[model samples]
Target: MRKLTDFISESFIWSVGITRPKPGQERLAALYITATLAASILAAMTMFLLVLHRL
Candidate 1:
């Protein structure tokens, strides 16, 4: 959990363009965050739909 929280914080920082990220690093970090968010949302939606279908 702590590691997850740390990754999220770092991703947020990179996305916000707050810190002086190294060349190409910022884009990679931002992409990582965006992908993570998209995957999470998709997984949640799938689970919700499955539950609804089961009911």
Candidate 2:
């Protein structure tokens, strides 16, 4: 019975932490994704302009 109770308590704490995203983690992820997308778009536009100039 004691072991079962301990197991349940540990599981609850683990689930709570795992289920929520920390604010800093969310912000970091957003910044990383935004930067990657912006870089990709800039590269694509540069390539397009270069191709147009060649033709």
Candidate 3:
């Protein structure tokens, strides 16, 4: 499971052209990616709910 997740993350970063982070920056990079994903999902869900409420 862990290896699969690592492979997926590596492929995503590679596809996005995000450079490999230094050893000290791994946590920060991970947090940034996670926060970005979370914020985008939250924004999409909020828009979805607002549209449904209007209808």
Candidate 4:
């Protein structure tokens, strides 16, 4: 049982490549998140407008 569990755990860890972040990468990540959120908001707003127009 322990061997099986260790194998599973090791496979999971190797499957994920967790690399250290480079300098100033936090700002880049923040910008990406902001842009993604903005895009989602724009899409939602456009859909809402379309639904209202059809009514």
* Candidate number with greatest lDDT: 3
Per-candidate local distance difference test: 0.71, 0.58, 0.73, 0.58
Using TM-score, give the best candidate's number.
3
Off by over 4 Å in 2: 1-23
Return the clash pairs for model 2, or none: none
lDDT of 1 by residue, 1-55 (tens): 4466447747677677666557757556556665777799999999999999999
Measured with C-alpha atoms, the lDDT of residue 8 in candidate 2 is 44
Tens-digit lDDT string for candidate 4 (1-55): 4454444434433565444236667445445544565688999999999999999
Instruction: For residue 10, give model 2's deviation from the true position in Å.
Output: 31
lDDT of candidate 3 over 1-55, digit per residue (tens):
4454455557669889888878887666666666677688999999999999999
TM-score per candidate, in order? 0.60, 0.57, 0.67, 0.56
Candidate 4 colliding pairs? none
For candidate 2, the clash count comes to 0
Give the candidates in order of TM-score, highest first: 3, 1, 2, 4
RMSD of candidate 2 to the true fold? 15.8
Q: RMSD to native for every prediction? A: 8.7, 15.8, 2.8, 12.1
Candidate 4 has an lDDT of 0.58
Model 4, 41: alpha-carbon shift in Å?
0.5
